[model samples]
Target: MALDRFALPARLRQSRHASLLLFAATLVLLLVAAAWFTSARSDLAEAYSHVGSRQQALTAANQRQQEAKLRVQLADSARSLVERASAGGFAENEWGERLINISQTPLARDEVNHLLAGMTRDHARIFGADVFELSVTRADEGLFDTPGSKGPPLMLNLRGTLLFRTAQSGSGVAAPVAALAAAPAIAPEAP
Candidate 1:
C-alpha cells in the first residue's frame, strides 16, 4: 500500500508539470498572434492615410485648374471688349460730340479758341508735321467737285512748305489758310 501511494504522488506531480507546460505554450502562441494582428492593422491604417492624402492632393489640383480656366476667360473677355471699343471708332465720336457741346455752350470764346489751337498743334505734331497740304472736309463731295464743295468735312485746310531749320522741322505758311478763310477770295479760285 505504501508503494501504491508513492506512485500516485509521482503521477500527480507529472500531470501538474504537463498542464503548466501546456498553459505556457498556449500563452506564447496567443502573444505571437496578437503582435502579428496589431502590426498588420497598423500597416493597413497607414496605407489608408496615404490614400486619403493623395485624394486630397488631386482635389486641390482640380480646383487650381478651374481657377486657371476662370482667369483665362476673364482675360479673353477684357480683350474682346477692347477690340469692340476700338473697332467702333469711340475716340472720333467722343471728340466730335465734345466739340459740338463746347460750341453750343456759353463758354468763353477765347478759351475755346485757345483749346482748338492747342489741339490742332498737337495733331500736327503727331502727323510728323511733314504734311504738304492737309485739307479736312465732311462726306464725299465727288472726285471732281468745285474747290469749295470738294473734300471731306473740312475742319481746316492747311497749306505750307515744310522747312528743317537748326535740326527742327516747321511748316512756314506764307499765307495763312485761316486768314484767307475770313476773306472770301472767290476771284482768284473762280474762272
Candidate 2:
C-alpha cells in the first residue's frame, strides 16, 4: 500500500509540470498575437493619415484653381466695362467725322490767316504791327518724288513773320522774349 501511494504522488507531480508548460506556451502565443495586432493597427492608422493629408492637398489645389478662374473673369469684365464706357460715352458720335474731315481737308490761305489772327487775338499782350514780307512756295514736288507717296501735292511753305509790339527798353521785359526764353529746347530727332 505504501508503494502505491508513492507512485500516485509522482504521477500527480508529472501532470502538474505538464500543465504548467502548456500554460506558459499559451501565454507566449497570446503575447505574440497581441504584438502583431498592435503593429497592424499602427500600420493601418498611418495609411489612413496619409490618405487624409493627400485629400487636404487636393482640396487646396482645387480652391487655388477656383480663385484663379474668378480673377480672370473679373479682369475680363472690368476690361469690357472700360471699353464700353469709352466707346459709348465720349468719342462715339463725331470721332469718325472729325477724322475724315482732318484727312480730306486741305488748308487754304484764308484758313491760315484766320488761324494766325485767332492766335494773336487770344493772347492780348501781343499786337501785330506789320507783316514785313510774305512768300508762299509749293513743297509738294519734292515730297511726291519719293516712292510710296500717297495723297496729292498739297503742301505749301509760307515764309513770313508779323512784327509784334515790344518794349523799347529792349530789356528782358518783353513778353515775346520771355516766351522764347522759357520755351523748351527741341531735341535732335533720332536717325
Candidate 3:
C-alpha cells in the first residue's frame, strides 16, 4: 500500500525544456513523413499517365496498319491493268507480243509480246510472218476459235487467233516450221 521514490536527480526534476524539445522533434519528423508521402503519390500518378499514353499510341498505330491492308486489297481488285484486259481491252501494239506461246502461267502483256516478238524475229528468215497481214480484229472474230472436232464443240466460241504465218513446227535449229502447208485449212470441227 506504500510507494517510495527514495532517489531523484535534481537536474531532471527542475528542467521541463527537455520534454518540450522532444515533443517538437517528434512533430517535425511527422511533417517530413507527410511531405514524403505527398511527393510519392504524385510520382505514382505520373507513371500511370505515361502508361495510358503509350497504350493510346499503340492503338492508333494498329488502326493505321488495318487501313493500309484495306487499301492494298482494293488496288488488287480494282483499276488494275490485268482487270482492264479481262474486261475487253486489247494489248497495246507497241507492247503486244507478235507470236503467241502456250503459257501455263497467267499471261501478262509483257509475256505475250515476248512470245510474239520471238516468233516475228524467227519468221523473218524462214517463217515469213508479216505483221501488216496479221489481222487485228475485235474480240468477236473467227481466227481465234478453237479448232472444232478438236474438242467438245460448243458455241461459246472463245475467239482467239489463227496465225497464218509460216506455221511453227519445231523449226529453226531442229523442228521444221510449216512448209506453206496447203491453204491452211480450218481444222474440221469435231462432230
Give the better candidate number (1 or 3) by lDDT: 1
Residue 89 displacement (Å), model 3? 3.7
TM-score order, best first, reads 1, 2, 3
lDDT of 3 by residue, 92-155 (tens): 2212222322212333333334434433433322223222222223344443454344322222
- Native RMSD of candidate 3 (Å): 16.9
lDDT of 1 by residue, 1-191 (tens): 99999999898899989989999999999999999999999999999999999999999999999999999999999888867754553222222111111112222233334433433433112212322222323355432455453223323222222111111112232322342233222221111
Model 1 residue 85 distance off true place after TM-score fit, in angstroms: 5.1
Backbone clashes in model 2, listed as residue pairs: none
Global lDDT scores for all candidate models: 0.47, 0.49, 0.44
lDDT of 2: 0.49
Order the candidates by lDDT, highest first. Answer: 2, 1, 3
- Give one digit per residue, the lDDT tens place, for model 2 in 1-191: 99999999898899889999999999999999999999999999999999999999999999999999999999999888867745543222211110001122244444544534432522222333222222333444433244233433332322222223243222334334343233233221222
Superposed by TM-score, candidate 1 places the C-alpha of residue 151 at a distance from the truth, in angstroms, of 40
Best by TM-score: 1
Better by TM-score, candidate 3 or 2: 2
CA RMSD per model (angstroms):
16.6, 18.6, 16.9
Error of 1 at 86 (Å): 6.4
